[model samples]
Target: MRNLLPFRSAPAPTSKVAALAAVTAVVAVAAGIASAPVAAEHTDAHAVVRDGQNIRYAGLTVRIPAAGEGVQAAAQSTSGDISLTVTRSAEGKLVVKTDDHEHGDEDHGDEAHADEQAEAQAVTADSARPAAAKTCTDRAYALAGWKLPSFAWYYNPAGAPAAIAGTAASAISAGTNALSTACGQKRLGLVPSYAGQTSAAVQVGAAGNCIGNDGRNVIGWRAGSGRWLGMTCTYFKTINGKKTVTGTDTALNTQYKFFTTTANCNNAYDLQSVVLHERGHSLGLNHVSQSANASAVMTPALSTCSAGKRSLGLGDYQGLAALYGTR
Candidate 1:
């Protein structure tokens, strides 16, 4: 049995790009079981890609016809199980093969011969893989296509009570500014808008339903066309009722929280600093574990709101410019 991890958040958007053709299936049953009547079955399931950007197979439930008591069949299948061994070929395709059969009766010699032939042919057919299977190379390429937008700050006293409007606007603006400077002058840009009575609510630290539910904070498109990018600043809130503030190796879908520090709203998590970090994700940049580079905004774990050197370091610029082509 394969151990499957429970999904904690919404699944990321998968590319609809067509894949290669399906390979033939191959099956091979044990020779000793050739004397008894054999029965077999097959099925297929889609694979799930995770936030950490890992690929996993969805279980394919198979049902085989029962023969008798001790006269049972041993079934073997491939590609459907979530084993690491099952993977895409160099050309990016999924291959599935299986071997299964029950003991056949020696009295039916001619029938047994026919069954063996059929099983052999089935095994050959199953050996080929499917073109639609997910591949690491394709996944990496798709991730490279994701575009990050310039961060923005919006406020609507009519939408949010005046008491918190100024604070929220100031906090978001500072974060956006700090990020732009660190990510590169034009790399991390900012949009201008405000939350209002009709505007979307903003969460901070751990507030709102930012933690557990599948909803994003910043909605709408900065470019005002094509794909709309959402933004979030993690605050306190009940995610499915939990208290977690940040998520890692995951996309910024409806679920999962985007957290920021309390000092950020109070002008502590420097504007340029926080914006640069969050915008990195907006542009599909994953967090880096480089501890030595204090200037790198993609560095894992937010320590302080200082400058972050306030500009897109070499790594950040290379990654973003590569995706969008340094415009």
Candidate 2:
């Protein structure tokens, strides 16, 4: 079952996309979650702060190998699709850094600048631009074929029920429901699998210590294996006190708590919302920062829960259709 979360007006496209394109061009770009905490509030900027504390990114990062010229070449080729950049370091390791341009602004504070620089340097050290793909839409379909059925649930019971499981069960259920409502029964059984189960080990509190920083909440797979792994966190009492933790990460002690207080550890968020979103990633969908379809689930940021956009929007569906050939 899909849990209903509030929706908000889609925010205007941020410069992060453009930066991502540029960076991805330079090197194949590369490209989570916790809690039953409430859905992340929409923000105009890339970073979101919760409860006057804690911070997170509207987008996630996918890391690529820093070793071997072949791997670097593949990263550069794929980077263009995600609008991210790749860089190689002296050690011949590749780091895929997000194209969050707002952090580059002088007014963002020294912490922000330092963070951006660190990311840039890390990516540059071993990253390379991904090769160009036919189109974002096409890539989505091709990637969808490669993904395994997957789902994410919070570790806290106070959070949405589905997001906590991070299991194929929730993902399959959500996919069936969403596809049924979107394309009817024609595409019912076509839902992919969520393989590649991994976790994004993020650090709570402080600037550089956000979700993406900790490398928790992120997951990926090589061209084959048909498995998709993503980063996930365990529930801890210091975070979610309830005996039944339905979410991925703990409250208060996790990145979600440090970033926004609006997210309730026990309730407030939707499981289907995050599952649907992350499932998109599992299916090869990238963040859409260039489109005007603010209501689209693939839009770069979710500004509100009132928009009733917990599911895939038109652009998202269309992108999928283009990639996989509509069933």
Candidate 3:
């Protein structure tokens, strides 16, 4: 079937002719899926895929690369139109590193796989800017070609620490709110409303197999000791040369420790701050250059115990406005 879910609002077409073609494309893709032969495995990282395989996540059908051919990180869709990005954070200066393995890169050749390696760095606030210069002077941002009409997300509180068990969920919701109202005094058009808590956890494996087949957008905690403080796996399909995101899963690494409120925050990372960054990704914003956009929430790095990210910088607001327009 077509990878773009019916629930999503497609970008407005310029003419009735273009609209008709879009519908036809969707039907053709669906028919192809129904008539295609079944593969030995579909989207399962544990199993080895030979000659590649087509796996449906939610309503989107994506092609997985064969083993040794490359990896799932480089897999695409049946029409050769899909990609995945696995983002994670590391210790020290709080860098949120991203690994992009697309389907058609000649080097990888649509080999879809997941990589969870965290790049550690000490990102100081003044790393690139003069100590007294304004942070928003450089309004830099990059879009990932996908923007949800609205964000519907769920939270899993199973692995939350006792100290912030009840409060963490609220903080997560607040992080989403930050993005919805990031542009000036208006909403970012891509409204994000809490969909309540879910028992379904993020489906990433220890080796970073991020197959978002559960269909529900979830945020939760997972116990792990590594440089990765958090991870977000976003799935999307390219239609009309535009990316339409199907869903996203974010998992916070409990092993790294976290503080919910700034009052109790010390050396640990700020829970709300991390969610703000991750939620930015959910809203179609890519990581801006740290050297130029260090103050922006979408910057690739954050320092521990810093609560400044709770607010969106100018570049952050500009990017949101550019994608969804301000409400």
Candidate 4:
């Protein structure tokens, strides 16, 4: 089946298009997920849990299915009892959903309190290690042999309030600027481009995760899954038989209380702080654990309303500078 999904990254070769043809065709065949099902199933609830899992650092539980066959059947999350319907994005980012799955701990009325706990429990995805000036190579999450040096991203407010979308846009722009200044490569910066079309790929009132080849990243709301502020899902493309990463797509949860201003630092999470962390993933950096005493922008996890990470810390810049180089 030929994929009608919008082109995700800058145009690739015919071979790459054919490469997606097989996967997208398989998706069309497996469950026709490109259209994305509206069915809701109740099962276990899941998120970026901290424990022992190889792909855990990336805050994802990955499963590679047979070629020419879609992953919907094989992608359900069995890590726990809850039903987690795993799907794939056009860019191949792993999309996990716990639709209508109610958890014992969910309480939507008090989001600030809920986010406080969620921020503590949920760990963010991968980061980069410093060079000889910082640390040697061979770190676990580091995208060794492959660094996501360049790509363009887009934003789809998805009907968010104008103020909310404006805040988010500013945060994302600040994030890209910080990364560009630190990495010293204008190309590594995540430029905001348009997706040309809108998609409800990520639904509201559920664990909605959407990533587009275009920059139309979505934000949705629901109180039950409020603990998850947002998580990043990276998609990979193999070239010449060697796995190469094309890009990393991110989704932010609207359930959490977000604070855009520097003052009034209540319990809400800072938008720029989270965007900064996820932006690092766009450059192929992994989770580099930071101490509470001196946390970097890539801290594995952060507290509520914490804007300390809005700027680059030593460890954060060290790895970025080493990987992408600085002026």
Best by lDDT: 3
Model 3: runs farther than 4 Å from truth?
A: 1-122, 125-136, 183-185
Residue 28's C-alpha lDDT in candidate 2? 22
Which is better, 1 or 3, measured by TM-score? 3
lDDT of 2 by residue, 1-327 (tens): 111111122242222221112122122222211112222212233332121112123332223322231110011111111122223333443322233322222121111121221122222111111122222222111121122223342222222223333442443345324632242213533344333334432222122221323312232211211111122222111112212111222112112211112242342223344445544543444444322223444433322222233455544555555444544
Between candidates 3 and 4, the TM-score winner: 3
State the local distance difference test value for candidate 4: 0.39
- State the C-alpha lDDT per candidate: 0.28, 0.28, 0.50, 0.39
lDDT of 1 at 137: 13
Candidate 1: tens digits of C-alpha lDDT, residues 1-327: 111211211254433332222313211212211122111232223433222222222321111111110000111111110111112222323222211111121121121111211223222211111122211011111011123232233433233223333554454455444433322235423342333222443332111112222233342112111111123322222234222222211112112112233343332223344445555554444433222222344543333224333445655554554454532
List CA RMSD, all candidates. Answer: 22.0, 18.2, 14.0, 14.7
TM-score of 3: 0.63
lDDT of 3 by residue, 247-319 (tens): 7777787766678876776667778878887777666765554554556666556666666677677667777
Rank ordering of all candidates by TM-score, starting from the highest: 3, 4, 2, 1
